[model samples]
Target: MKPHKLPFENRWSNGEHGWQWHCELERLGLMNVRAMFADHETRHPGKRAVIFDIPGGFVRDWLAFHDRRTARQQFLWRAIVIGLTLVTAVGTVLNLLRL
Candidate 1:
């Protein structure tokens, strides 16, 4: 976990075929996972027919995007919780001094 590595960037290579082709995978770090799968169809030409038939690869990409989204949502929730706690603490002190 490098200091600058985003969470998804860290987990991106933990999946199948990820570690073996880490460089190529890293190139896709900024792309929406769906775009990567669509581009794969071009690189592997004949593989398209089978890929469209099953769509497992596309599903994997969606899952990655969804997981990343969920992580972001959790982070926001945590921030909100901390903010509310601080506000409550300040308000409590202010109320006590006025009494």
Candidate 2:
């Protein structure tokens, strides 16, 4: 299978179509994989094509980084929510005691 080509110039140009172009490229790669698998099946019986060869630590590291970032954001939001709730509860208690 030929390597997929990327539109580097357009991607780096800060254009809105960068994501659209990426999706198109992904679709094209999938189509190519289907075609390659079909050809492989005809030529070799009972064998599967290895379409992707990812490094061992890549996915794990990516997930760990994503989890850390997500946790940080969640902590920030939770702190803000808790602070607001505490303030509201305190205000209610003070108003009731004064009445």
Candidate 3:
């Protein structure tokens, strides 16, 4: 593996309480970004930031499912913003031409 030459501590071994959980997920090619921000203790004592145990067989599917939702949300938001910007630009141009 290539060494990360960054001038700071390794992220995978940071002091964060849930660092181990995210490290395991990265090894399995899955991620729960939300957990990296804030995590709370659960009623099920053993469970940490991951909340659910993702079996090896479902890791790929879980990644796909999670990433797809993120993509769809970002696409919708960007499309709306771009469409609104275009409409405003065209309206301004037309108004200027009328003057």
Please give the clash total of every predicted structure, in order: 0, 0, 0
Q: Which parts of model 1 are misplaced by more than 4 Å?
A: 1-52
Candidate maximizing lDDT: 1
User: TM per model?
Assistant: 0.43, 0.46, 0.46
lDDT, candidate 3, residue 84? 100
Q: By TM-score, is 1 or 3 better? A: 3
lDDT score for candidate 3 against the true structure: 0.49
Error at 64, model 2, angstroms: 0.3
Cα lDDT of model 2 by residue, 1-99, tens digit: 444443332213234433343444355554564465455556753443222432213222333444576799999999999999999999999999999
Predictions ranked by TM-score, top down?
3, 2, 1
Better of 2 and 3 by lDDT: 2
- lDDT string for model 3 (28-59, tens) is 44334334222322333344324354332233
Give the TM-score (vs. native) of candidate 2: 0.46
lDDT of model 3 at residue 20?
Answer: 41
Every candidate's CA RMSD: 8.0, 11.3, 9.6
Give per-residue CA lDDT, model 1, range 1-99, as digits (tens). 322322344333344444334333444553544575666566764563322342434435544756789799999999999999999999999999999
Question: What are the lDDT scores of the predictions, listed in order?
Answer: 0.54, 0.50, 0.49
